[model samples]
Target chain A: MGHGPGYVEADEDMSNPLGLKAKLGLDVFKHDKEPHITIKAGMAGDQRLKKAIIVCPAGLYSENAQGEVELTIDGCLECGTCLLACGSEVLGWQYPNGGAGVQFRFG
Target chain B: MSQASTFDVIVVGAGLAGLAAAYTMAREGLEVLVLERGEYPGSKNVTGGRLYLNPIRDMFPDLWAKAPLERHIAHEEVCLLDTEGAVTVRYDGAELGTQPYQSYSILRAKFDKWLGKQAERQGAMIVTKSRVDEVLFENGAVVGMRAGGEELRTNVVIAADGVLSFIAEKAGLREPFKAHDFAVGLKEIIELPRETLEARFNLQGDEGVARLYMGDVTKGKFGGGFLYTNKESISLGIVAGIEALNEAPSTIAASQMLEEFKLRPEVARLIAGGETAEYSAHVIPEGGLHAFGKFFGSGILVAGDAAGFSMNIGVTVRGMEYALASGYLAAQAVIRAKQKEDYSAAALSEYERLLKESFVMKDFENFKDSLHALENPRLFTYYPRLAGDVMRDLYEIPAGPKARIFPTIRKYFSVGELWGMGRDMWRLMKI
Candidate 1:
């Protein structure tokens, strides 16, 4: 049988948003720290940030009840969609620490 | 010497382009350091499985014997999906998969790490998981980069930093990727029994196949789906235009789109009873030359996806080969510059000369018009329906008299529509 690190034994069922993170196999930071990507808190009312809430492919960006930016960095795919959605003024974009973000098991 | 002055070349991103450039430079006796953002080289990368060997073979002959390649692709399949049916055209040839094979399916996590190791074997320092935060410049020349709060200096900075290329942006080489120029690809690696996968794809040991789907697969958007056979799994995915998706007359989430695609009888047949091993999403540049920016600046050169080196010509979506080629050329230019001890834009212009002479520029410039033709709505929506209607007409027997072939074909695609398709074909395939 052809077997190696890239191959994984799979289970039936569509991977949901929560289950998707596990499949990504990202190595998490040991300590609670600031995320590499942050939505501009002061610019929460900015229209671009508002639109980024829906445009982000990972669905990691959202809006609070007050229609402000709410972003979750845990499952960020690092595709840079949010950066493109909201430029430097409203988004802080950087690669996650050496080895602590979205790691694709089969990319 | 200080830590910043240790290396001659410091490459950000340990993907294929970075590795290829490092390997070439290191082999030529230059001090090289490669910084990777992922836990490993390939962990942050993805592909549709076909890595054209021509460029790699040109760079490193006999690489296939040791590379972590899955299978040699010998069969090329094209399927067009419609509202209710599909039409497939298959090509099987004996001359394929011979020595110096054309292409193969590969898992990037293994193959890229292998490429990284190859470069490491040649004395390249590959620092995995270290993401370069910024490219430091001096007097309009790139001097080095800072990563993880540490600064490292080098004579040249090669930006093989994938599609987004924050490093390239730091050098002022690229603008923020716009949705119109980008396409988001979502894939599922579905594991299956080796024998089952072989049988399902109609292949013997080691032989593989690839299929590209047009039409309803993207829900009528300006993009397509692909299935590439790996050893124990199938790399199945869809690439849809992000801007098109954003403005789609009707739309659903990319996750929903993939789930719906998996339900299609045409797709469901291939992966029946299989399980999804992993799920992934990435964004690729599909705007041809329009997506490209300045590939070079003083003391810096951009390669791979970061340099906008990918091309999607309908029949094939190619990036890795272009990445390898650009990386190799960048190294050649770097080697030449090192001899002269000048890393200015004038010295780096040799890299552009090499690319212009190679398949990198020739192919993209040759196929530039297809980038426009691919956006034609008919190819994705109306034409696939036409194909389905034509297939249905040809297969189903009517109780009455049979119609002539020309009239039957014309009925599905009228004369004007045929002329329009002819123009699209002419524009896309003129090269």
Candidate 2:
């Protein structure tokens, strides 16, 4: 009975921290066709973008082998953490259009 | 049926603040419209899972009895965690368990949806899945807003939007965002059986516990972790300052902090057999009154996180009560302006005046220096380790001989450490 909608069983991986994708799977999201956030062109290699890799609670930001930061918006929590971490010059950020993005059922 | 293009009031974002303002004004016979950018009122909301009601109870006098509150908090705990050991202090006061309880554990998704219903019952028209894209201005005054590609007119607009308040920015009421002024929080709602939760938390019927963890929980960051016992689940999460996470000597994902916190021996055993029901993250305005910008503008007012109402004073963290109270006061100011048939900046300044005279402004003014005082790195690192070490040495029995109690405790407090402690204490006096 404790299992409600969107509940995901905790994985048994103890050696590694809970994977971001699995944790995001526990939330309800209404997908949007267009990405709501993007790393600004030419600014992907900006040092400011490095903060996004560390401060994004969803771990949506990562540095590629090219030393450029990349972002995936599928699991964006709409928390605005990355925006706050990386200034507007390096990231194009906005909330997903109305009714899209992660929806918290037990927030 | 054609909906009116104009409303007496348009409150953006259906969190606590917007709902409170809508409910207050609708009950006064005003045509209030609340625009929400989510599937439902609380669908985009998140909290640390507790609301302090004593400060806001009188503002919404009749709503508490039937509110969707999870449990009345009867116990308060603080856990200081080092890399290895921990020190915890629990307070179970008789007054805390009595009627007229001070606070309750809350789940915003449930409470906000219920609040929207209450506001509707009071004649407020709520439009869900409607995002306000722009603030409409006439002669440099806010006249309405554009949402869902439709221009909606209103005499005044209330920006009750959450922390990252774009509406307030669009209306020219806030300064540019600063990383140091905000913190990000990540929470997981872990579900368990009611009996198991009750037994684990030592709770009676409808009783709950609220615990805060510091030090290693955030990896010595400027924030901490929190756990609140719900009726049949637990809300566990971490709040780390964005600046702290960014400026750390090494890179660490904020989510990893929560993962490690859940594995701490002191926390792992409590929820050994629970399932995670939901995961959420939110940005909190932690800069205190110093970060507050122009809250009232020409025919526009800001409330809740949009106005930077949240604060962290080491022992307690609060925002919801301020949100609810500020929303109520904003409505009162609008009602007063309606009587004069004016929505000018001069007229709407009453909102700021009312806030200054209320507990909301008084509390902010009283603790305006809290955030700065808490920025000292020692509070998050040295102190916790010192506490854990002292406790360990005091309780541990040596192999052959036990050291004298005074020396065992006194050895850690060298002259330099004592001086640092004194300086920290003097800084905290501002709060």
Candidate 3:
């Protein structure tokens, strides 16, 4: 079963009308929209790094700290732990290309 | 008749669905071959790691005595969490701890691999690391499949290749899945000492609790998150609509959303010292009635995720059970088709009949409204926001005389401005 109305729409005032309401339109923001990232720490903006590294950290959808598993097990969290560990700036950590990543049945 | 070197039936994918099919076929004296793409049968597979025992027991009588089960859960808890507070419902019955009932937590890598071995003992040939490239057809009838560039012919091909089933698409049995048809599930298996797990969750030896967290898990973006207990590991995950995440703002990546969930004061308390053991993600088919297509066609039968048999609407993500059931039914259909010397789509249609006759299709038909109900946008959007809004006022504990409950209740209803709660209630009733 899903959250009872008692649980989901519990407090009316505690809710922030801004971020809370905007986040509701995830579908509108995701596919129809795209994200713009300004890379400052990685390789130079113009120069092409020879290695196209993918930083798949321990938490496939979350970042991890230093002492974590480095190998990819089909379900990497994209946590950026390895990216920070590698520090090579070669690892390009982003969500799975598309249609790939974690799924949830309820929120 | 073509004298193929292989066997009468070739079951592709040694996951639970495929293994169930192969085991059933072999028991009936049919030569069955299970080809797995993974290095081992379940090595590439992952699940929430809990198995409701009744279904498994129905398939294999007294299976609990022999199946490779991890632990039988004695307790279950459902916790509804917001950014600040949580409300929990717990069900603990000793009866749930015993016979013909109760669910066991499992690791697919171990469970599926063991089940494959069971099928082998029953005379099924399981070939691992053999990816089925395509299904072979002669005169527009499925005869076998291509594995690693080699053609292996058989009487029937059972497609149980999971959510992104390539074989189903290749055979023209199904269309490509849309974002609305599925959810992307991410999970982490965190390991805690055996004693710690029991103590943390307030459980005895094998008892466990499964918690479902809503609200901030996906940063209040539609889908929900879950945490289930195993013997010594906790399976934590977040699953959301693919389209929803694509729509979120750039400041919050999906990963950061999950981070926000774990970092929440309520959720963070649970996994305080646990070390992460494994992380995995798999596409879960959430499409209910609208997603189910033809169950069989052209000398082949589609089972499990390939047929969009997953039931993912709040209560449970139920493809594995349906997979095992549909796979067993498919095998029976193939056996009948072989006996009648007919592998036409009409003959394979029996599989569909059996599915409808079983809980697989029956439940889907019964709860068909769930798809539209969940997709209504109000559940995730308006509901969570309104809930957080009201609770903010109700929970303020004052040191002086307690504030009258009437004003807070009035405030709660007034701020939920859209449609009245009555409309949502009516919609749920109609669904």
Candidate 4:
């Protein structure tokens, strides 16, 4: 089926894959001075860390040029999908202190 | 250690469970303190935006009259989709539209904030922007917790934290996390004009629709997509098994899956002209009874997602009611313990007993195998595609003579496929 009559696009920008940055920008967030999550030292290349790339809803995990997994904590939904996909051994995860992380207005 | 910081009972997290516990206890003249990490009660809470009231209405007898519910769901639908086509089944029963409606669409931010106010009015003290940093123990029993560098003490502590509860784990009530036991959901609250939303969904005043899509929604993963009609917005989202998403031959980011799902013709038309108001994600505890660990410890109790209270059994997904019930029951157990001057594990075991005697545990026992049954990949992939292909052939009016309907449909159900279907049906019967 194709778009029927009277179909109005929600937003032109939505037609494109709303990248991680743009999707996260739609919600409210309070930035923390220090990232709440970090790849444990010397475990960046661990196989377990790779799963976060697929399961993190915000798409916060990615592989660098060296094929080592990297993570940016901004826009982290604090869903803990990464921590479950990758074990605690490869990632040090915690909710941003007290009131520092995301503040969802419509959750 | 000061008496000013101590309370009869302290509840962590201010979602449904925490609020319910505080409301129940505070109403009974027991001092109750609720701690929430977010800016407000629901700042970090998420749901598909529907709540079944039949199970919880009686539990909170007077609360529904003025609750800020969005709409009463009058339509139930399920859609099976393939790459090119889709099959949809809609159910509209007269009873669904009658008074004392079974369920209603809800927004957590609005609903939870109102519930917080109700709890506060009942004499419960709630402190927002406070996150529990440590679960303190004395003589191997939880006595209190530390939050925001302040040590708060209480006679009993209730861990009503959401899924991925650090409080539960730190108190030795839950085991290490397992990927197979959870699913991640991403949702967008797309706002539409009230008139447009009602007309588009064919809903009358205060009427709403709840639709679920399987198959291509999750790219054959073990999860599905859900849409709920709110008063002026649609809650559209996809839930995918973390393990399935991770172990698939080709990896696709969860965020990309949502974007694609919205583009599907069947979904796109429904949401046309809507403006996305917000985007949120949260992990759901879908592992059912098998994944449950200890829910109570000495001087402590676990409730809500923290205790794995959510369940999905194809047609209905429930959690909020379970959270409300469990929190209420936990409060009951604590009240009993306080009367006897006991906060030990043996006394708190009453919480589990109360659950087993209620619908909360009974429902879990009945459908404990649903998660395993839903894990079959063919249910999400092969079946939807087969149904779509069969439908396409049956509906096509070609240039040549049309084939007989029975034969055209029968051709695809080979003996092997029939046997496989039988096996899958047998497995499903267990739930």
Candidate 5:
């Protein structure tokens, strides 16, 4: 997913366990390798497994063993700068249902 | 039992308030239908985009276990700023880290969609892309709602259709909201690396911080800006009063003001190297407690922004909590009215009374002046510039003989034209 400047390619070398770093503001290439932290809950899917976790590194999108995971996130502070700059469709977005989602606890 | 109707109850708007009301009624065995004008719930909703947990505690006690929470807010910083600097007051607590968290950061698309699904699971029929054209009335009493050229009957009507609800207006529950009574807000959700977010704001784990800015960010206009930390993204935006904005010397639209706001050195540094994820705009009812119009009519009830219940007190922007609380209370009233087999205005007036009894109305009532003070222009304009100038002179390390800070402040205060600073401060004090 890191195709822009300073993007260190994700190595296909199976023998090398090290994950390559992506460009600034882009990281989900080998995010799955960031350790399988158990979530215990918070996912929607086959729930037979008593424990599950998906690691999404902090750049808005997180990748897991199941590939890019899509989750509904709310309570976002309304800042239009990032959306004005995002050039992807992976993020399905809108304000929290009116009267739902993030309240500027202190604004 | 061949009742000729699409559902027993028809809810217009798929927002949280609407969904909550529909869900509550449906869970109790009523055949409820939710009609949304957007492609989906939250699609047309806009908030500072933060969801407080107080209102949802009863409905989804284990929400953190299932709902998508961007970040659990552990610290909140409310900053008063000038062109060059800021003074921030922070309220940090370890209590916020646990269950029943004070608040969480969220993206509405995900939150509202999930909420709609939850409502659907409770047996309410949620229909999207259906605009409610009018409220169906019989003998001056609301009997149902009309949407997309289709009329649907119900025992009650919920107008949770957001700030400019036509249904409420059409029902004579509210008038067309004046520009001064409302605010135009523009926001952007920017994505950043988890490590970067944590490092920049000194956050640990999933803990997040919310920041509010007043003063120069709005070009001394009667509005403020906010920056909140999410899981891997930051929500940044500006909300300004439309009347004050229109009265400004410059033609900076809400969108343009947001652009300028983000470019400020303080905000720009935080979002530096971050990727813009989404851009959205919406209006907020900052009319405070005095703006709440008639909340209910014959067989109808209104909650959330539709009723002009948002409060814009300094350091706080509360609507969601009010919306959810009011929604729940409205549902309770509706259930009682249903049991009594009466949907008249008298039967439904319970919603208004109960809402007034709840903290929703109390808080709005207490801080009515805060909303007025925010619109006074001094907090956004003169103070920021004067304060910034003061800070620059006091903090700057000069090469020659040091000028005493007190005298500098006195001289500075004497030098600049305060332009109603005294009156603004006096009124703000009362606020």
Candidate 6:
């Protein structure tokens, strides 16, 4: 299902994950900001399940070579997808400081 | 304890709800303060971006003349897509384009900012870029809000904060919304030249179209997709209940679902030559009243998405109306509470009373079944495909005797599918 015509490849000129974000003017997102989420150390060690790596809407969580879940907090959409998907046992979710996170131009 | 730290009412979040509530209170001559976490109101929000005006007309009678409205939606459609083609149910009329219009598409940043300005003019203090870290309490009664390491007192605190509001949790009203209780949405505002947009969408000046897509968009998930036209831009996106999404046979990412929908020839044409303008994702409450939190407790009253006032009523998903309505009601309740000199849960109960007495509650009651029908995968998946197939067969123009419409539709529907739809129809009648 992933390979066939059932799947539509994003335009070649477009970047799958970010081309849209760039056009959305998210490049000016508050990148130099505080982290609103705390990923438990060795969360990947349990390896029981790391759904956050796959389920985050922003694709913010990815597995590192060391089997650690590396999170790119700067691009976090703050939609709380990962927060809800991660469960409290694995993550500490908090809103970004008053004005220190991704901002939507037309939201 | 200086006067500067006190207010008659304080609203958290400056989205439609907070602004409406603040404006209502301010208009009553109460000192209202609204703290928004965004750089400006709506900087952290996302919407399919359409505001149905009839519901909010009383709150802002001359909204059309003063609000930063994009366009009055005169054209609307529901596009059912199978793999290669689409079956569209289009509705258009001059009546829909008249004053006190059916609806208008909006950009939250612009609309919310305008709303905040309106509240300010009515004596409300709208503080953008200030987040309410938590709800402040005194002697087990909600009293004010703490933000940025500072505590400010208010006779009442209205949590107009969006969904996933920690303020709700801070008040012990409820925990963070679970994935099953809500759907995650991702949207992109594509910038298009007005002439090109008008030409492609067959729109005249200041006219717009809103489209809701089923099938193939969410890859047959419980939620669907939307395309709303804003004067020079188009908002398109998919919303899938995270529970259904996580349970799907495929691990389709949200962005992948949107990309596939954008690439569909049916959608591509409408957005051709348009530049991607904004990308955003938000969590919308899907579960109706069942998943909603308490309306008021002590001095804290939760409204908007924070209280789960939004709904996904089949094809016409609604939030802004409920948010604005609840905000208006909450403000009215706060005014009454101040008059009674009691912000207790009992005194603030008026908020829920106003809601129960308004369409906000009645509509939720009325559409409970429709929402039920929508949650059934068949509504978004099987039925659209079946409808699309029947529509396809009817119009294929093959050189043969024409097939009867009933049998043609039945040919695509199994006995079980028929039963399900029959039940859906019956339940819809009850609604």
Native contacts recovered, each model: 0.52, 0.80, 0.01, 0.73, 0.00, 0.59
Candidate 2 structure quality by residue, lDDT tens digits, B310-339: 999987999999999999999999998888
- Candidates sorted on TM-score, descending: 2, 4, 6, 1, 3, 5
Best by TM-score: 2
Tell me the fnat of candidate 1: 0.52
lDDT of 6 by residue, A1-107 (tens): 01222232246544455543343343237753668897777575544235665456677776778777777676778888777766767787788887778788778
Give the candidate number with the greatest DockQ. Answer: 2
Per-residue accuracy of model 6 over B89-176 as CA lDDT, tens digit each: 9988778978768899999988888888888989999887787876778898888877887878888899988888788888998855
Per-residue lDDT over B264-315 for candidate 5, one digit per residue giving the tens place of the 0 to 100 score: 7788889988866555556678887667778999988998878887887777
lDDT of 3 at A78: 28
TM-score of chain A of each: 0.68, 0.84, 0.28, 0.82, 0.32, 0.69
Tell me the docking grade of candidate 5: incorrect
TM-score of chain A of 2: 0.84
Among all windows of ten consecutive residues in candidate 2 chain A, which has the lowest summed lDDT? A1-10
Give stretches of model 3 more than 4 Å off: A1-107, B1-5, B93-95, B249-251, B376-378, B381-395, B415-419
**Model 3 TM-score (2 dp):** 0.78
lDDT of 1 by residue, A1-107 (tens): 23334433322355455444444443322222569887666887787775555455566766788977787776677776667546788887777777877677678
Ranked by DockQ, the better of candidates 5 and 6 is: 6
The second chain of candidate 5 has a TM-score of 0.93
Count of clashes in candidate 2 = 0
**Fnat for candidate 2 (0 to 1):** 0.80
Measured by TM-score, how close is model 1 to the native structure?
Answer: 0.91
Hey, what RMSD does candidate 3 come out at?
11.2
